[model samples]
Structures are given as structure tokens and as C-alpha cells.
Target: MRIAPALLAAATLLAGCATTPMARTAGPANVPPGMQYLYGSGEAAALSEQAYNALVDSVRAQLAKGRPATAAILLPAANGTSAPGTCGDKPYAAVFDMDETAVLNLGYEYNDAQTGATYDTARWSRWEASGAEKVAAVPGARRAFVALRAMGVTPIINTNRNAAGAVPTARALAFAGLGDFKHQETLFLKGDADGKSAKDGRRAAIAARWCVLALGGDQLGDFTDALGTTPAARRRSVSSSAYADWWGRRWFVLPNPVYGTGLGSGWDDTFPASTRWTDPGDAASVAQPK
Candidate 1:
């Protein structure tokens, strides 16, 4: 999960909105609003539950239609075209991103909040190796796993967590009650395929063996690397007709406001100029009576 420079810049800008003079004086209140909403709010929990429920339903419906002709994964072709992986009697499986999608790294996040530091690769590597006990399964993930297994669908984790920490990563998933994830078999990591952070290669490897019915993650890269880098490009890519209907049908995204590629958007990218509005009154006069 390497944060791009653009995303880092956006995060720094957005941090200003979260940290105010009053917030800085409040001590423990220094936790960013995004972190609070993602890690502490019930709304995020409900959203996770809703996404999992939809995913399960989608899988069930697809299974009812018998074997699929193509996998849910988008495969890039050398001829400048892309298509879903062809399915040929492969076992049914659902691919999911682990961190923030399947489990919450409560311990690492707490430390981060306490220190007010940006993402640190070395620190994250340490957490990956030692933070198993501090993780919790995302809401509804446990139940979703049970339901998927009961329906004869295997749950597979494809995360950007390093392969060197495979043992502890599996432990973290199990600790969070998500069941066992064996390296290279049930769990695929960053160095597992092509040694890149992008997951499309790993996804291709998984799709080659299993008929992927559903894809779940907090970042767009979990599903495909074709999404453009910018905020506007990413939004348009998802909303395009080719993928517009895939949201709740074959792809499920869990909420992750704390951090990710989705966090960095400027004011112009977030709000359209046509929608801008002016108060049309003095602040002192408005505050005098209203």
C-alpha cells in the first residue's frame, strides 16, 4: 500500500481541515475526523455489513445461474484490450483485500494517532509482523466468510502486505476470526506475483485457478490497476458504463476513510465550480441575530 506523492500532498492539505487551533489544544481529540469515522463510528460498521451482505447475495445469485463463462477479474491483454478471465470448470472463489477491508489495524492506527506521523514503510512492516493480536475483523466479514464457505465458495485474500510477513498476516486474519489463510494458496501478498504493489498480476494468478465470483477491497487497485491515478480520473473510470453496474453486482468496496488512494482530492476535484455558492451577507451581521 504505497501512497503516491499526489495522495500524500492531498492528505497534507486535508490534514489542515482536520487540525484546528481548538483541536490542537484538545489533546486526545487530535485524532483526525476520517480516523474517528472509520475506526469508531457505527455508520462505518453498518456500511461494511451492507457491503458484505450485498456481496453474499450477488454470489448466491451468480451461483444459481450455474457456472459462469468468465471470472469477475479484469484481465489485461497485450493487444490493448481487456476482458474478464475465462472460466473453465474452476472452483468458485471470492478475492478480498485484507487490511481495512477484512480487518482493522487498531493497534497501528492508535500509535499513528498518538505520534501524528504519516505512513512509514518500516513501521508498517513491523506492524505486519507483530500486530496480529491487535487486529479486528471488519464488521460482517466473519459472517460473510461462513456464508461463502457454506455456499461452496472459497474466500481468498489478495493483499499488498509483504510476503515476508505471511505468517503473521495469516495470524492476523485468523485472530480477527476470518479463518486461516495459507500463503500463496489462500493468501497472496505483494511479492507473490511480479513483485509489485498493483494487484492485477496477483488477481490474474488467482483467476487462472478459480472462478472469481466477487471482489472486495477498500481501494480500486484491489479489483484492477486500470483505474487512472487522479481523483477525477478514478471517479470517471468507476462510473464508466463498462464498470458502472459492477459496484454491487460483482465488486464490493468497504469504507476506508482513514487512509488510502481515495483520500487525496483537492477542492476543485471535490466540488464543481457550477455548484459554488456565496453567503451574500456580512458575517458579523448574520451572527448578530441568526
Candidate 2:
């Protein structure tokens, strides 16, 4: 539920740099790189469309194979990790994260970039309540929703948005062309289950009533909280033998460079020491061999 501090710091730095009078009036150049890439670039849209396409295709194949014995959600296991929840005679469904996965918060992000403000829960709650027309569906999300419904699989939204804003959140989804989402049924928000920001509890609640065949989100935590806190640990956790195979099969991820847990990592963590190199032309450094 916490926004990455590193990302906020970076935004603050960018804001600090723009204190010059000329920078105040700058247009897109003033926007952060991540915001530019996520909200403005075609690459982000293509990546989102690719994920939704894969999700629809995978869910179709899964349905063709008949009823699965388990849902895609992870449950607390004896080994301290997580395992898929068992499915009984539950109805079929596909669970998804709402923000940046199915709907793009265009207006809110625009404000973030324009004001260069760090993430604020109070402001976000206001947006959730009254920013219905300021959003748009992520590429292919509308189509994916329709397709999943046509295939007889219910599409459910599992978001960390506050339960107090459930009505407006549903309205926002509908405004974005993602169709209707009933709170506590097709839509599960924060405070609906255990009242914690962690979504596993709500996911379990959904799994109890439906057999989720596919899961989609822009962040790793959207799938399971067991993915660890640090970047390296999360990488290893996700790519571990037990979870590697679920990437494009039972799980789908949309690109979200703007802000999230994925944005936290130092230079050393991002690039290993062995991968470090210096240019031969640099006067103060020795060049490392490729």
C-alpha cells in the first residue's frame, strides 16, 4: 500500500530542478521520464495490449481444457511461501488490478507531473471519488473484459483503493469503458475483507467463491506478497522454480514505469559489480573488458 520512497524522491529532485523561471512554463519536457514513458509513449500502450491479449488467450485455452483444480491466487503454504488455492465447484473468474492495469488515471497523473508532488493518499482518495471522467481504459482492457465475459468467465477487480470510495471507483471503471463492477462482488477494494492494504485476504475471499483462472496486474505484489521487499529478493522470488512457469500462463503483467514497488532499487542493486564498466576515453577511470 506504500508508494516507493525512491520514486517520490526522484520526483522531488525533478521538481527541485524545475525551480528556474523558464522551467516553470516548460511543457512535456518537465514531465518525469517514467511518466512520459507510461502515459505518453506508444511502447507502454503496446506492452499493456500485449499483456491483455495474452490474458484473454490464456484464459480461453484454460477454459477449453475444462475445469481447473485450483485458482491462480497464491495461498499461505507450510513452507512459509505460497501455493495456489484449491478450487472446488466454484464459478470461473479472472482477477485483475484496476489502476494502471485496466484503467489509466490520466488526470491524476497529469496533476502529479504538473505539480511535481509526491504520492499522497488523501489526494488519491479525492481522485477516486470524483475523477471518473478523468480516466481511460488501458489498451485492450475493454476488449479483454468483453471477451472474458463472452467466454463465461466473470472479470473481477481487486484493487487497493479504499472501500469508502467503492461507489465512485466503480463509476470510474464504467467511465473508462471497463463496464460495471459491483462492490464486494465483482469489485473488491481495501477494507472489504481484513481492512488491510495487503490484498491476499481479499484474494482468498474471492477464491473462496470463484475459481480464478488468470491474474493480471502492473506490480508483483498484485499477485502475492511473498515476493519479498528488496528488488533482488523480489526478482529471485518471482523467477524461482516454483513461480517461474506462471509468468505468461496463469499471470499477466502490464508495464507501469510511473510508480510502484518495482521502482525501488539503488544503482548497485540494479547493476552488478561484474557488469560495471568505464569508457576507454575517460581520463580518471580504467576501462573494463566486455
Candidate 3:
């Protein structure tokens, strides 16, 4: 109470600093699952690269075994048989989605999120056409495609980016140094009415002539047409079909948090916010086996 004026001012400043939250001495017990974008950026990139590398290995193994028929087919025609690549009747193809699987859409996504826009078709079309030059290849994608081509497998890109953007899309891939996509046929865009969104018909067409060795994309719809909008529906699709079992083996999925069915608004409605943290000590305890 009797402290000097300068001494009192110094003490007050110290008190303010002390009460302000210090840097966290320890990490949080657990990050909320809903905040994956905040915490899993690096994880997403790493997983995308890992998925491509694994697909390469899977294709290599199937080739060595001389059993292209054993490889998972993304789609089947009425006849239910394509010229298998193993028998040398036709070249094998590795299908991939263009947006987030082959190229990073982070730049466009960040711009859209800043403006709080959701799926502006015209805006997206413009972005796709003009923005390809701005995007970069997803990690390991160029190398993976080049490697596949070296192994006598063709790399086919099946994207929902507008059919008009096909030329720009190919230029974008080439800009990212993935020049292996020279033929327009290799880059199948949403040109036809049937191929705008649902890719089952397009994939089936490719499967008719060439053996599909593997497929890669960020969304479940990229692999097959048997997709449901809900989380339960997605899980059921994988569990119900034998072909869906080829997830890690023949279907390599990249991670995308910016846009996808994975971003759902029902989390808070389903699980109360109170469940975010149970106990501070529970973090280490829960990580250990019971």
C-alpha cells in the first residue's frame, strides 16, 4: 500500500503478465475430432503421399504375379470382362481424380473459405479454367504417375472439373511437370452428360478396353457409384460390397478437409460439446492399453 509510484506501476504490470495465459506447458489431452483441419494438415499431406506409394507397390506386386484380372476393377461392363493387361492384350491404367488427389486445391479452397462461399458452380468453373496454372501437384503424384508409366501402366485422370477445362487441366498437370498425360483421352473431364458428376459410366467405359490396375482420389465417389451421402451410408457401402474391400489395395484415397462429404454439420447435434474433454489425466491413461 505504501509502495513508490514507479514500484507500484511495475508490480501492476507483473500481475497483468502473470494472469495472461502462458504458453501451454503441455499439449491438450486430445484435439477435438472436428478440428482435424486445424491439427491434421501435415498428416493429410503425408497420408496422400503414402497412399500413392502404396498403390505403386500394389500394382507392382500384381504385375509380377501376372494376374491383372486379380486387380480391382473400378467398374464392370455388361460383358464383365476387359482385356487384362497381364495377358498383354491391352495396357493397364491407373485412374485418379484431378482436384485434390492429383493437384492440391488448397489455394482455391483457402480463397473460397475466406469469402464464406459454398460450391459456386460458375465461380468454380472460372477458377478451374484459370486457376490450374496456380495449383501444384499433390505430393508423390507426379513421381507415382511417371513410375506407373515406366511400368507399362497408363495414367488416366477422371475429373469432375468442367469438360471445357480439360485443356487447362492437362496444361495444369503439365505445369506441375506431369507431362505423361499427353493424349486428351488420358484426361477424361466431365464433357458428357453422364460424366458430369457420376463417374461409374466413364470408368466402365475405360474398363471396357483397358485393364484398370488402381484408382486414387480423395472422395469415395471416385472409386465407385455405390456411394451414399451420409457417414453410415459410406461405411455400409464399404462393408456391403466385395469390390469395396479393395480400399487400401486397389483404391488409394487422398485426404481433403477443404471440401468433401466428410465435412458434416451434425457432429454437435449427435455428440454434445461437453464430451470434448473428460479429464486432464485421462489423456495419457486412455492412450495406454487397459
Candidate 4:
């Protein structure tokens, strides 16, 4: 999450609800400072790099045999829908999210954390508009992007950033060496039509014009209707019988802990002891702080 510098400077730290720590825990009560950023900067990058490379390899193999992959990453795991047939030989395309998936906004995130800023539209707009020279591509993203073109798959960029962000967004992608998508239609910005943030409509529009082979992003919404839902509801979307099967083969997910639904979804109040684990040891043995 990010906010304006002024807001950051004036914001007061709020007190969180006090809770007793669980007994037998192996680590500290609070997350160590900067740990989340470190994961996004280091470990997550490496994993994403591998995933992109694997996707390229898989796509290449399928294309080599003059056969398009039957998988549809954009389709919901629970539905009867399938990848749209090529729209009258329109084209085979691959879709990706811009931030955190195609481009690494680590610099923005780090600066926000260091300066104690919160995520606001103005701040984010400034970052997108002029922060390009600072942004970088996700590892392996450039190579995979290049390969997509070679495989005869048109690369389409779909981002939730508003329409005003199109130019800078393109600049950043190009600056990072992943700028093959030069055409206007290739880049789909948020609010292209009716102003709902849900990407399903835009994705449908793209699918109507092309055969969408794969979809990749850091959030569940990148692939399905998992955005803006409660934590449990989001979990159910991915785990339920309708959508549980196409994890690695169709949908490719990258890790982003910085600012997802959990950052805004308030703590869940319901608790059912029956759903929790039961250890063999006596419950009385563990000390509970008052």
C-alpha cells in the first residue's frame, strides 16, 4: 500500500487490538520490518522468473507441432466455458497484468515503505506517469515476451491502471526491454469502457477478438473473480470444486504480499473451534498470556 508523502508525515499510528500470543510459537509476534518487501524483491522475483520461463517453454512446445494448447488460463476453473476459438483467424494471444506481473514496482513500494506513505491515486499516478526510468521488468519477463512474438502469439497487456496511465505504462515496459507490444489495441487500460474495475468484461472483449492462451498475474482477480471478496470467499473461489483443478497448467500466479485484498479486508470475526487443529498434548500445559 502507498499514500501521499504529506499524509504519511501527518498520519498518526493507530493502536491495534491487543491479543494474547499463542503458546509454542517459534517466531516473533510481529513481522520483522522490511521482511515483506524483501520477499517481493528477492524470493518472489526468482520464482516468477522460473514460472515465466516454464510458460514460454510450454507455449513453444505446443506451437511447434502446429497445435494450439487446449488450455485456457483465462477461463474460470469451475465453469463450462473454454478458451474462445480463434476469432476468424484473428490471432493467438497471451494476456498479462502490468504491475507486479510484467513490471516490478519494487522501487515504488520500497520508497513508500521507507517514507511511511499510503497508497493514494494521486501518488500512484505520479509514480506511473514519471517513475518509469526507475521501474524494471520482472526477471525472465523480457525473454518470455520476446518468445511469445516468435511463437506467433500476440502479446496483450491488460492493466487496472486508469487510461491516463497508458503512455507512461508503455514507456516503462519499453524502458525495461519488454516493449514489443507497440499497438494501441495491445494495451488495455482500466476503465476503457464502463468504469467498473473488474477485468472480466475487458478480458471477454479480448477473448472475443483473439484466442487467449494464457493468463498470468500476482492477484487471483488476474485469472478469475477473486478480487474485492472477503478472505474466506477468495479462498473458496480458488479451492472450491468449480475452480480447483487448473492451478499450474492453466493459471500462473505470482506472489505479491505488499497490497492485496488482505490489506483491506478487516479481520474475520467468526471462529469455530471444530475447524481448528487438536494437538495430542493437554491444552492446560500451554501458557496463555492474560
lDDT by residue (149-255, candidate 4, tens digit) is 98788778878876887888888888889874543488887776446577777777777677777777777777766432676677666776556765665567765
What are the Cα lDDT values of the candidates? 0.85, 0.83, 0.65, 0.64
Report residue 273 deviation for candidate 1 (angstroms): 1.6
RMSD of 4: 7.4
Candidate 3 lDDT by residue in tens digits, 48-133: 77999999999998889875554455444357633222323566878888877888754565454334334567777687778767
The lowest-lDDT stretch of 10 consecutive residues in candidate 3 is 1-10
lDDT of 1 by residue, 35-123 (tens): 77778899999999999999999999998998989889999878886788988999999999998899998998777666555676888
Compared with the true structure, what per-residue lDDT tens digits does model 2 show for residues 1-290? 22533264453333334232123346344566666777889988999899999999999998888888888998888988778998888888999999889898889888776655557788888888889899999999999999999998999999988888989999999998889999999999986788878889999899889999999998997898778889899988888998999999999999877678876576777788999877778866555444
Q: Candidate 4 — worst ten consecutive residues by lDDT sum?
A: 6-15
Give lDDT for model 4. 0.64
**lDDT at residue 222 of model 1 (Cα atoms):** 87
Q: Which candidate, 1 or 2, has the higher lDDT? A: 1
Give the best candidate by lDDT: 1
| Residue 220 in model 2: lDDT | 91
TM-score of each: 0.90, 0.91, 0.73, 0.75
Model 3 stretches with alpha carbons more than 4 Å out: 1-40, 74-88, 180-184, 191-196, 241-244, 265-290
The lDDT of model 1 is 0.85
